[model samples]
Target: MSNSVPMTVEGHRRLQEELKTLIRVERPKVVQDIAEARSHGDLSENAEYDAAKERQGFVEGRIQELNDKIARAQVIDPATIKSDKIVFGATVTVFDVDTEKEATYQIVGEDEADIKHGKISITSPVGKALIGHQVDEEVRIVVPSGVRVYEITRISYT
Candidate 1:
């Protein structure tokens, strides 16, 4: 059985837009390129044909991948979830125990994970450790470097 994919409304919309672009623009362009390449003299000696075929394969694979992800997506609205505890789509403020630095992260799905943007995947080590915890709770997470402790300072949704 496939695990449920939890994603915010914005994330779902982004995926839909990507799929639309691939189908409407990329697919047709790749097909035309392949057809044009095929019209050239010898397929064995044609670099254009090989390149076009490779590009077609890549585009088709991405299209299928996007379709599968969209099909399995379980859209969840952040506003609807109660503010009792930290959960998926929650913006959490944490204080690093070692450095005493403050950082905030919004728990998100794998597809939407962008550390620079502070959108962390719920499946990540830090996110997994923060799940179900409440504000003021101290949590320990194991990173590639080592285990680090973080104290949850605040939680918000937006």
Candidate 2:
């Protein structure tokens, strides 16, 4: 579909796993809780029933969201990519011109962005600036902290 979302293979796998857990485990647990709460006499003053129903709604919504994400996911494998310039699924090392520090980051889809692991969303400012640029190219991007310049030192697909 035209509304497809790009994501790494690992991101897709994680979503699938969460969907499985919600359907196979959480769904049944919530159903049991509702049943037990219903057996406790009057439902008018049953706080447990209300809570269980709320949780069930949340779980069901999450499951549907995960399913939609998985269905629209365009999984891109980094290992199969080959290019001299930066693009989605490329791991790049850049030297900060102002700080004089080097950092590595992988340009990934929005769903796969994890800054803690050095993975950045392709739609992010830095990632967008790096795209289509070759090694040793200086890229200047305006971020929240003002303009920052970086020199691309390396690019790898794997």
Candidate 3:
């Protein structure tokens, strides 16, 4: 990409680990699978060969994609930052205005987004609404499901 991809140190580390696995473990195993399939001799009728070739293509494509992401990554460590306003890497606790409950979400990069784990991408509707907001601030965000209202309660590095 022409622009750097913003991410947390943890997200960067995860991508690097995936890349390393694809290169060291997956690449060699796929290569061996291709060779073994090739030994079957009949190219057109070789289903194993076709499957192995497809797998190789997938692995190679993922490796290249991961390499590009890693090269363009702008890693930010949350633990190293201290900010009152919600920003990237900030773990925020929000009180739902309608649900009468509170939920915590970490503002993270796209690759680190996992709603199930309470990590929301900075570009997400809720995350966009939360940025630059401080504790006790009310935020209104329009999502695909509907509009959401949240009150910022806490902000933590971790």
**Considering every candidate listed, which one attains the maximal lDDT?**
3
**Can you rank all candidates by lDDT, best first?**
3, 2, 1
Ranked by TM-score from best down, the candidates are 3, 1, 2
Q: Which stretches of candidate 1 lie over 4 Å from their true place?
A: none
Clashing pairs in 3: none
Task: Report clashes for each candidate as comma-separated counts.
Answer: 0, 0, 0
lDDT of all the models against the reference? 0.92, 0.92, 0.94
- Residues 62-122, candidate 2, lDDT per residue (tens digit)? 9988888888888999889888988789999999999999999999888779999999999
TM-score of each: 0.96, 0.92, 0.97
Off by over 4 Å in 2: none
Candidate 1's displacement at residue 44, Å, is 0.7
- Model 3: lDDT equals 0.94
Which has the higher TM-score value, candidate number 1 or candidate number 2? 1
Q: Output the number of the TM-score-best candidate.
A: 3
The TM-score that candidate 2 achieves is 0.92
Write one digit per residue (lDDT tens) for candidate 3, span 33-93. 9999999899899999999999999999999998999999989999998999999999999
Deviating ranges (above 4 Å) for candidate 3: none
Cα-lDDT of candidate 2: 0.92
Model 2 scores worst on lDDT over the 10 consecutive residues at 1-10
